[model samples]
Target: MPEKLLFGKYELGKLLGCGAFAKVYHAREINSGKSVAIKVINKSNICNKDGIPDKKIEREVSIMRQLQHPYIVKLHEVLATKTKIYFIMEYVKGGELFNLIANKSRFSEDLSRKCFQQLISAVNYCHLRGVYHRDLKPENILIDENGDIKVSDFGLSATTDQIQSFDGLLHTVCGTPAYVAPEILTIKGYDGAKTDIWSCGIILYIMIAGYFPFYDQNLMLMYKKIYKGEFRCPKWMSPDVKRILSRLLDVNPGTRITIDEIIRDPWFRKGLKFIKFSGEEENKDSLISNSFNAFDLISFSSGLDISGLLKSNNPMDDLERMVVEESPERLIERIEELGKKENFRLRKKKDWGIEMKVQNGKVTMRLDVYRLTEHLVIMEVQKNDGDGDLYKDVWRNKLKPIILGQQIPKIEDSDS
Candidate 1:
């Protein structure tokens, strides 16, 4: 194929890589003299040999277009031609975190903390946005010239509002075998956020040791160890470091140390020498730990531009009509009724706002409301079954679009 202009602007420089469905290129922005990466997928790839339509790649691109965050790779622009689709993204020059570790053996203590801080900030941002980045690994983490990291590849991510557990058990077998959470392997229901945390713990271990905690030619054995959270910290590791790692690698998601707590821990603090690179303010005590409060967690979303989703046509558009005349509980009950009719079971109450259980009378699917604006409501759902198809189908087929668009209802409006 001859070289072609993407989105009528990006000039393709050279082919970077090829996957089953798309080709990536290193490209240059014609106007600002900036560089970028462009991925082009052929529409033909969306169809099977029999020409059956496959909308998966298109859906992935649509979802990518809606997300904007610093820690997450930015999808700058997308253009679809009759035969192909193009994704223009900010190019991170430093390559994968995996390559960095392979070359350096292991990171210094201070460097690990800095990297962990960035990772947690990214994960927290996704959680608040009601998105879960289900696939997180060293290879998927891209670094830039300034040593900052960007979490890439949301191909496996999904909106939590719609996903539910499968057969009362978790279902999706997707994710890198090594970094996957123990609960995921058992085919038991698990939170997407919690799964990310498990990967984060594994990454931390790799950053410090330059090797995976569980590795073998046999994949099954590796999975077995992951479920048990069984691994030995090298004797050379500091006691403080070992203590923090143990908490993050906990097999039970419920007790797994949270990101907020990890960032607040002292072990992570010891790695912040570079934060004061100017050599003038190194004396200030570095705050370090993994634990963080919900309030502090929101800070990570500072760089995210959630306006796309907030502005999109959604079902909650009739907020004013729904809010002014009815109590908040009424709205909750209405939504609950709708859910039950669709086979989802309600948990009767909620912590932050409201909660619901979706299952086949055995497994649990999670739906938790985080906040509600007069015009908008934020929610997170956890589905283990990968049967997220049911909810997505409902949105595309049942829920009326444009119900809500671009307006966040104030807390005062939704609060009791």
Candidate 2:
């Protein structure tokens, strides 16, 4: 027998996540059987004393309803009752992209390129529809089970309606300090599109450098550095990366790299996965009326163990999967090559898995390869036993680029 339904239309499952103001639960659509993540937020945080939804929440819902992109999270509908509001969104099994980066400290060039490409594609689409994501930090970005980007958190977004008629710019000063554009600090006015591009540059830098490009203990000092475009690129970054980042992080918004320029750049165009939009037209009349407002979407946070923005997967939910377009044999062969080059002993296990050992077997690693289709394979990497410099050398230097080229990241989240 099925569990009792919530709202009489959805069957709720395990608690995916929760925070001070909201809880996210896995659920199934009763009629359509579609999987979704339902975020339940307390009405107190999103409504006034009179019980009307906050204007910011309403604007977020309005903006999100208009955005339909593959790389962005899909908000199916909004529901509410006396005490709480429910947000039915696409179910994303994997948590934030911030998790893997936190574990690795940095990403290989290939992986960085893949993430940046997806971000740019989504942001470009948003700008085309006159929407701007004021906050583009790691907390607002998510990854799905398929290892694809799912941009989330539109609470700080703005549309054409918010632009000032007198100056044709946005006067609001909002967003995470580290990612906010330099011009936003002036209090004069700034182009929303340009500020969004600036945030993108900061994100790309963090992916490659494992740190913020502009940061300081003093907020004013940090703002000064950002205003002056004072940042040092890591020496190990490739020439192409450094070159593009220079243009992207330019302090002068007037000269910053535009979306078209980024699309045409050789580095961004490499192995780019061009995701198509749904049948939803860019300028189609909004299908929604004001019948539904929005819940407080900022109650959830980022990090594998993160909580805050509405409801996300549990910080403890550790299942991660990636689909690769390669034969299981080919994938195994590549991993074997990496093991051999790193002077590690490898043994076959169960005809489809490999166990690797280094430093006299003190550090061990295992990979289980499964063929999902004739041409698609999924590999799971598990760590076992101790850790040492030899382990880092094998994993970071020799194995990463070869095994995870433009693939969804493989973060070591288990205790094994």
Candidate 3:
């Protein structure tokens, strides 16, 4: 009945939403009894008709996998078949932040500030991990059952590794026009993180003012206004809030306030909880003593074709394991090296692998590495104590290189 429970584990409940290439369904994990949102993407539509690069979907998964922040949506697992790809994600009950704002017409300064603080905290965490959410708006932001914020829709996100060029700037022109930063309109390369900050400012403006900072029926006029950073704050707005907005909305990316600076600002620091890191020296000795599991290297190297290694007749079992090539020693070494660069602290070590913690501002992510065999290793990364998903791009762009010793080939598309 009901197609024998999609994936042999998840019981599809109701249709949640659908987009151009995928449909989202509310589902429950039969074994774990956990609720999740399963995004079913038609392989034919994405790869054939729409010509969407497989890597775009892969990158989104990659970025979401490594991000373990309170304000970001979580991707638990991915399953792909001949016809479709399914992403199991945390089911956020509360709906889009835009809906809340629309219903209220505008939020009080205290509420708006709280939402903006959470938004900035999440964005700051992304920046610390070298991830950039190219798209940031009320529509992409969600409110949980507790009324906390959760950022979602990372399909347009770009990591430093993805956007960095010889000049160290991103040239991509992607994202909703209204929420896009001014620098993105120049056609010249721009700093991904800084551009994201600009969008954050716009979201904050809308939350407090109940309207877009720059709006006109003519698209060209709107662009002109955005490029000039021309927007007037309501007279009722406080001077301190206006000052922060002005700095974030600066026309020049160079003049924009950095995330660190934002965190330090008096207005931003108010009511925010700061994350602390230990000063203890990293366990370089433990990393050196451990041997790498080859399976992990092979798995990361295969990229998006992990499903190709599935051999079991049962979808649930196959989804749990992937066999691949590579030595355990090399993979372990590579993960340790990359972990150091990403501020991940080595926690525990074993003969086959190790566990590490990545602390970003107020979030701490726990990563586990296990050697399934001499040539097979598996990695499980998630928040130390939450259902949030870690950023995925970190694994694809940062850790994958350590395994394969090269950059993942880029696919050119008119949209990018």
Where does model 2 exceed 4 Å of error?
1-4, 14-21, 30-34, 277-416
Predicted candidate 2 versus true structure: per-residue lDDT over 1-416, tens digit per residue: 12348878999998876665678889999999988988787778876777555667667765776565668898777776666677788888888878878988998989999989889878987776678999998777888888788898887898866888778899989998999999999978999999999998988999999999999999999988999998998988999999899999988999999988888798988887544323222221221111111221221111211112333323223222456778778888988876776687998764467888876888887776655445666665556555645556656665656666543345686995
User: For model 1, how does the per-residue alpha-carbon lDDT over 130-227 read when each residue is reduced to its tens digit?
Assistant: 56677888988988898988998877776654356334223566788888888887656677777888888889889988899988889988888887
Q: lDDT of all predictions, in order shown?
A: 0.64, 0.74, 0.71
The alpha-carbon lDDT assigned to residue 68 of candidate 3 equals 57
RMSD vs true structure, all candidates: 10.0, 24.1, 14.1
True lDDT of residue 177, candidate 3 = 82
What local lDDT score does residue 253 receive in model 3, on the 0 to 100 scale? 92
Give me the runs in candidate 1 sitting further than 4 Å from their true place.
Answer: 49-55, 165-170, 269-416
* Runs in model 3 lying further than 4 Å from the true structure: 1-4, 49-53, 275-416
Q: Top model by TM-score, which number?
A: 3
Model 3, 1-416: lDDT tens per residue?
13438878899988888777788888889999988988888777656445444667767876787665567887777787766778878899998899999999999888988898788777876775568899899988989999999999998888765655467789889888888888889867899889999999999999989999998889999899889888999987899989999998999899898876776788876776442213222122221112233322432432334233232222222122233365566667777777777787664432443555544533344444455545666654444332223334444556556666565455589788
* True-structure RMSD for candidate 2: 24.1
